[model samples]
Structures are given as structure tokens and as C-alpha cells.
Target: MKFALVDDIKTEAVKGAKGICPSCGSEMIARCGNFKINHWAHKGRRKCDPWWENETIWHRSWKNNYPIEWQEISLLDEKTGEKHIADIQANDGLVIEFQHSYINPEERFSREKFYKKMVWVVDGTRLKKDYPRFMKGKSDFITTNKPGIFKVDFPDECFPYAWLESSVPVVFDFGKLFESISGISNPMYCLFPKHENYYALIAEINRKTFIKTTLNGEWLSRTEEFLKQSKKTKLNRTFIQPIENTIRRKPSKYVLERGKWKKRRRF
Candidate 1:
């Protein structure tokens, strides 16, 4: 797919606008630009650092192929002065965020202060490598073929998107995420915007057993319990390790049998 921003914001305006900075509500915001990417910048040093670095990374990776629509936002909580500008818009009035680096715990808690439905997408693989590098044998992290999608309903008190700022790594196993949504027939498929095929499989799995198989490229074995077990968690979430010695096989064609030459001679 061709990548470009879906919003009306032009390439030039995407860098900076006169509007107040979403993080601090400062009117000193300005636009910055480069050949490949563009985003807002503060005119002077401000309190909250813009998440431009994080946004740049994702833009470089998928911007040319999958442009994201960035909406200007400045959400505030009446109780605290904390604020957040979500990364993207979810189909059903939900907010979506893509985080790459570690975030402050306080910052995390404040993100979901106002929203009812919010989704946070972080680099699960990076988290695994940072924390659980040495302790491999204990939990036995079973890597699935695809990155798992998780839909965790937050406790009313806890901010749902707050986990994005947790210093501890958050992990997700692809198999586990699929299993969670398998039971619900025709569950909403907006959680993972990157994986379109998964949405179709999820619908099929919910309707009948053994109908839809595999995601990305990994073939799934038939087991309802196993499907349920796959999930993205705060522990060992990462892409599944590829099996090195797996023998590659090709499909074979059947051939018709021929009678011995002796029968033809007798005739």
C-alpha cells in the first residue's frame, strides 16, 4: 500500500502549526521539516518533550507504505494537569498510541484519565530483549509466529493507556491474543490496524472450528485451549523464533497406474 498521511494536514504544516502544543498547551510551537518526515517543534525549551523521536521512527518504517492520519489534540484532566496527544484514531471513537521507548510511570497513568476506550501499541520485542535477556529457562517464552494483539479493559481507577509508560517491558504472544478473541463471533477488528488478514481469520475462527489457520506466515495447529493460551503480556512478548531445521516440503501430484507390457502382447 502507498504510504502517506490520511489527514488533510499538508507535508509542510505537518511539521509545525501555530496551535498550542498538545503536551503543554504552549503557544510557542513551530513546524519543522525534513526530506522524509515532518512534525511539530516547540519555539523554546518547554517542560514536556514532544514525542517526535518516537513518531519519526514509525514514520520511517511504514510512512512510505502506510501513511497515518495525525490529528491535532490537546486533552486535559480536571483532577491533574497531565496531558496526552494520541498517535492515531480508532474506528469507534477510541484512541490509539504507538510507543517505542520507555515512558515515565506518572506520564502513563495520566494518558487515560479522560478516555474510555484507548489502545496502546508498543514495541513488544524490544521490551523482551531489555529485561528478560538472561532469564530464558524459567518461564520458557514460547514465541509465536506473529506479534500478539491484546485488548485489556482497564480498571476504572487505572488508566488503560498508562501501561505505555511503564519502565518494565510489556510482552505479547501472538497465539495468546488470537485465542482471547476466538470465542467472540465477529468481534471488532480494530485493535491491530497493521494486520488486516488477522481480522478476517478472527471472524472465521469464531464462527467455526478449523476454518481459518495461520497468520502472517505461521500455520496454527488445531487446539482451542492452545489458541486461548497465546497472548501479549507484560512478561515475554516477542516475535516467535524461526525453527532453523524445519524441512521445507512441496505438494505432490498423483499419477495413474499402467498395466504391464505382457497384457498388450497377449492382445
Candidate 2:
């Protein structure tokens, strides 16, 4: 499977995950949705930590929970003939970078012009926050009155993206790490894939490992099998109405290989 390491995971991905800087131990961290993975940005004192700007809430958490060796990398900014430090680097060909700086013309075009197996976490602050700098027409989860409301304004040109509840952009390989949701440890994973401004109903799995089989449409029958082995199901849910609606709209598109509980609808 192809994996892309991002400097930040989408805020939506962290909606219930947790909120704290991975490095300097700060609470003023924010996450936005990027192509498929989420992007994180730090907003606080600049001098307290050197790695704060490069680390997001999830990144910090990942480091604490699982300390993996990362290498320092340098990449040339094509727009400006200068070199910048890559956010996080793996021994393999994985390079993670986060762009929290205010987006200027050069910065915007700089990302577009660069060609590497890189992940970009764009800002959706206008959609997620109440700052004076927020852009018009951006969605905000805080302002929206609806429950289970997560919105992120994504640029159409971006690839493999998901809109998080914080109205932050999250981009990733939709087919790869998405399965990770089903394996979450404590917090139940509830995923709602919102595309084209359409949202599916809430659906969840107790743990991340379950996502792989569930994604294959085995939730109903496999629910029992998963329950017997699940460590945390007290509050676990992930849903996508479009997929269900798709199957309902066209039953021929899906093949039910499990059992006769086909007519049972939980939502």
C-alpha cells in the first residue's frame, strides 16, 4: 500500500482523537483537512518550541505513543532558490511537511510547482475558526447549530481530500490509511465522508482494525464477530450515507456476501 506521511493529520481526524501539540505540549493547536490526510497548524508563542510549527496535535501524539525514528531532511523551495527543512522524514521515501504560514502568492504557487511524493495540509481556518482573518463563505463547526456537523471547504483541484468537522481540509490516499480509522484504540472512530457538499449519516466502528472488513461491507454480519473481540465499543461509530444511499439507489452495485440481515437498517 502507498502511504504518505503528513506533518499534520486533518482536524476532522482529530475531532474526537485528542487536541495537544505533539512536541512542545501546547493546547493552542489546530488541524485542517488536506487531500486525504489532515494538516495541523500551531498557534501560540513562537519561542517556546522550535518544532512546534512543524508538529501538529496528532503528530505529537503519535510520537508520544509510538516513538519512531525520523530523519531530518531538506528540500529546495522552487519559488525561492532557498532550502527549507522537511517536517518529518522516514528512512524510506516518505517526506512530511506542513505549511502553517500565511499563504501568499509565492507560497501558494510554491506547493503547486513542487513535484515529490509529498503531502500538503491546507488551511480552512475561514471555515473552522472565528478569527477576524477568516475568509467569507467558509463553514465553521462552532457556528453551525447542527450536531454531528463537520465541514471543510476543499479546493476542487486538490486530490484525495476529506472535510473535517473543524472545517479543516484533510487529504490522503482514500484507499490506504482510511482503514486506520477502524483501528482506533480509545476513541470510537466515526467517519462521515462528505464530498460535493453531501454527507452520509453517522456510522462508526469500535476500533480501527474493523474498518478494513467493514469497508468491504461486512458490518452487519460481522458485527457479532467484531463485538466478541472488540476492546472498546462503548462509543464507537463511523458512518457514510453516500455509500449506503448508493447501494440503495442501485442495489446492483453492491454484493451482499454476509447474511440475510440485509433489510435491517440501524440508522
Candidate 3:
């Protein structure tokens, strides 16, 4: 963990420092070794929370982007007496989890329920195969009326299987920090929760924009608006388009796949 309680104050890990776990109030000893980044370890390294994952440089970078006080917040559920440390619980009550390790679908669902209002910032570059799969799937993206929004026929092809059914928005960060030219060439992509069975909605998100909006508490509202607009788009295409406009038009470009003409739908 990045921060621990020393003298009842949040402090970063330092060699020879002994502190208390902010979440479980257990003894924490700072380990400043050559292998991993300096971090506080629980007594005997017995993890107090099963949900907690080992932190990496990427995780530390994301946590440091927000304010110090917001990083590694301890949250509790009064009803279940459940407690866990959140990576970042924004001032606006939005939890931003920076996930680098794999999480099973059941545990993923449990976290979503715990942090009802949350956003997942997944490390897409963790596995070499991840970004390549997304690039392959990107060629099939169906453009939407909204500039940065797209309709994905098969989201599983582009994103990690764990995130396809996320209750909250999951943003994949495929860029290697300091390696890109502009963010650099890799911008984050957000896969929205399931909307329609036929396709999934995705948005190209700018990293800076996401951080600013989240800090000012606009993230939730903006996400809700996007969800509503997607529903409207589906409704318009299904029922609101004029009958003449829906008629099949002369095909300028067509491809046959599995006995169906791709791109045959009226735009």
C-alpha cells in the first residue's frame, strides 16, 4: 500500500519505518528493497483483505494522479460489516480502481456492488496480447452519430473478457507511460456496460478529460448522459427513422459474410 497511518497521520513508506494499516489497523512495516517499489507490508505479510492486490509502478502512477488524501481510502459497509481499501475515492464519491492483475468475474461483480459509483482504469498493456486483440477488433467498429462513440458488434474481441459485463464503465489504458509520443498515440478506450444484445457502446476517452471531469464530479452525470443518448440512438434507428429512409439503398460498398451482407443496414 502507498500510505499508512504513522502517528495517526497518513505517510508514505520509508526504510525502517513502522506504521499502522489505515484499513485494518494492523502493524505495517516498510520494506525498501531493490526488487519492488518501497511499500508497507502487514505483519508477516499476511494480507488483511483478500481483495487487495500487490501494487506495481503503474498502479502507483495512477494513484498519485489524484490528491494524497483520496488515495487508498478505506470504505466500509455497515450492513455486511465488510471493509476494504479503495484505490481512489474521489471527493465526488466516485471510486476509481486501477487494476493491473486479473480478477475473476464473480469477484469483479462483487467489487462493482461494493462501489456502486465507480470507474475502472485497467492496465491494458499488462499482457502483450491485449492491445493486439483490440487493434484487430477496432477495424470492425461501427461508427455512431456521436463523434467519439462507436457501436461494437463483439466487445469481447476488443476488451478483456472480465470487463465485458461490468456494471460500471471500464476504461482500458493501452499506453506505456512515457513510451508514447502524445498520450502518445494510444488514447484510452471506455467500454460501457451492456446496452443492447446486438452491439455494445464504446467511447474514445481522453485521459486528461477523464481526470478533470472525475475531479469536478462530472463523471457520473456525463456517463449517465452518454447512456441515455445511446438508448435514444437505438430507439431512433429502430422506430423513429422515416420508412423511406429505412428502405435498402444502392450499395456502393458491400461484403458478404456468413450469408449476410455486411453494412447492408440503412444508415
Query: Which lDDT tens digits does candidate 1 get at residues 179-258?
Result: 23225532222222121211111111231221122111111223223334432223233653422333323221211123
The TM-score obtained by model 2 is 0.29
Q: RMSD for each model, in Å, please?
A: 20.4, 17.6, 7.9
lDDT of 1 at 24: 56
TM-score of each: 0.39, 0.29, 0.84
Cα lDDT tens digits for candidate 3, 1-267:
888899999999999999999998899999899999999999895897889999999999888789999999999999999988899998889999999999998999999999999999999888889888887666666655555667755566678767777888999898643332123244688888855546677788778888889889999999988787666657233322221223333332333344222444556
Task: Name the candidate, 2 or 3, with the larger lDDT value.
Answer: 3
Estimate candidate 1's alpha-carbon lDDT, on a 0 to 1 scale.
Answer: 0.34
**Candidate 3 Cα misplacement greater than 4 A, ranges:** 176-186, 235-267
Off by over 4 Å in 2: 1-59, 62-71, 76-81, 99-108, 121-267
In terms of lDDT, which candidate is strongest? Answer: 3
Instruction: State the C-alpha lDDT per candidate.
Output: 0.34, 0.32, 0.79
Q: Candidate 1: worst 10 consecutive residues by lDDT?
A: 195-204
